[model samples]
Each structure stands twice: as structure tokens, then as C-alpha cells.
Target: MKRVDVAYVLLFDEQHEKVLMVKNKGANSSYYTLPGGAVEAGETLEEAAIREVKEETGVDIEIGGLSTVSEAFFEERGHHALFFTFTGKIVGGKIEILFPDEIEEIKWMEIDEAETYMYIPEKLNGYVKTNISIPYILRGNVIDKG
Candidate 1:
């Protein structure tokens, strides 16, 4: 059986038509993506999103309702991930790049331009098309037990 993990991809509204995003680190470091990470054991999905957003962007957020869910499999990495998407509102904290190792830079871009970013997963693209200004969840694949 393959390992399974949960992650959140946060979308912060700037009170305009633009949304906040972060340039991911590691192999796909060049592409920009939402600020979120893995869900730790004993934590709820919403808790993980709030924690991840603060940890990655240094901005505290009020997580809203679920928007989407996606299951994905990484054949090359031999891992499965279930992404839970949540809508969030920026409540407080100064915007700063907190996780330098996992994120390169934080950027605000027009909602329409979000697709230009390579790291915007395909599952997210669907939600973006429907709801113009809401955060979404993507719950990904479960490991197949044989």
C-alpha cells in the first residue's frame, strides 16, 4: 500500500480582483501556488489550513467552508494525496515570507491570471472557473489496498 497525506491550498483575497499565492519550493520551485501544506495527525482539515497559511505566509486567516476536493496519485513519487480545499479570509498579521525554504515569494495576482501559474493544480482550475472569488478544497486519492 502507498502512503497517503492531506494538504490544503489556501487562496487569500486582497479585497480586489487579485488573490495571494506563493512560489513553491523544491523540484517545482519555479511555479507559483497557494500557501498550504500537509495535515498533521490529530488535526482537523480546517485547523491544518489555518496553521499552514500562517506558517507559510505569516498571515492569520479565518477558514471558511469547503469548496472542493480532489484525489491525486503521484506515480513517480509512489505517494497519494487527498487535498481538502477551504475558503479563507485574511484576518490579521503582516504579510511576510515565513517559510523561505518551502516558498520563494508571495504574490497577488488577478483571479484570471491565476491559471498562468504552473503549479495551480488541474483540480483547482475547475473550481476557479465556477466561483470567481472563493477558496476551494481538493481531496485527493486514497491508497488502494490489495
Candidate 2:
């Protein structure tokens, strides 16, 4: 059986009609995505979301309700990740590049502009226009026997 871990996808800055996203480093370099990471040991999903956002972007955000959940499987790595997507609001601190190694750049992107980015998933793109607030839990490609 593969190991499963939880993560979060956060959307913020409705005022500018933009969402805060980060450009990841390493082999998948130049790929830009949301500001979030793995949930650390013993930390709640919300806590992990808040912590990851701040650690990656240097901004404190008031996490809003759950938006979506997704399960991603990495066949080569033999691991799966279940993600909880949430809406967040900037509460304090200025947005700055915090973790350069993990994050290459931080930017605000309009809905239309985001489509050009390679990291934004296909399923998530529709939500930008629908304006529907619903929690979505996505199962990965792998089938579960139980």
C-alpha cells in the first residue's frame, strides 16, 4: 500500500480578482502553484495550511471555509496525497518571498492569467468563473479495495 499525506490549496485576494500563488523550485522548476505544502506531524489541516502559506509566502491569512479536496498519486514515487483546498484572506504582514529554495516566486494572478500557468490543475480552472463555493474531494487514479 502507498502512503497517504494531507495538504491544502489556498485562494486569497478577491479584491484584486487574483489568487496568491508560488513558483516551486527544483526539478519541476518554473511550475507555479498555490502556496501550500504537506501537513506536518500532529498538526490539524487548517494549522498546516496557515503554516505552509506563511512559511512559503511570508503572509498571515485568515483561513476561510473548505473549498475542495483532491487526491494526487505519484506512480513513480509510490505515494499519494490527499489535499484540502481552502479560501483564505490576508490578515497581516506584507507578502514577501520567504522560502527561496521551496518557492522561487510569489505573485498575484487574475483568473484569466492563471490559465497560462502550467501548475493550475484542469478541474480547478472552472471554479474561477462559476463562483460556486463547495467542498470537493477528489480521489486519485488508483482504486481502493476497501
TM-score of 2: 0.77
C-alpha lDDT of all candidate models, in order: 0.67, 0.68
Error of 1 at 115 (Å): 3.7
Q: Report the lDDT of model 2 for residue 96.
A: 91
Model 1 C-alpha lDDT per residue in residues 99-134, reported as the tens digit of each score = 788788888877767755524566666445444333
Error of 2 at 146 (Å): 35
**Model 1 weakest 10-residue run by lDDT:** 137-146
Question: Which ranges of candidate 1 are over 4 A from the true structure?
Answer: 1-3, 9-16, 116-146
Per-residue lDDT, model 1, residue 104, is 84
RMSD in angstroms, all models? 7.4, 7.3
Per-residue error (Å), model 2, residue 90: 0.6
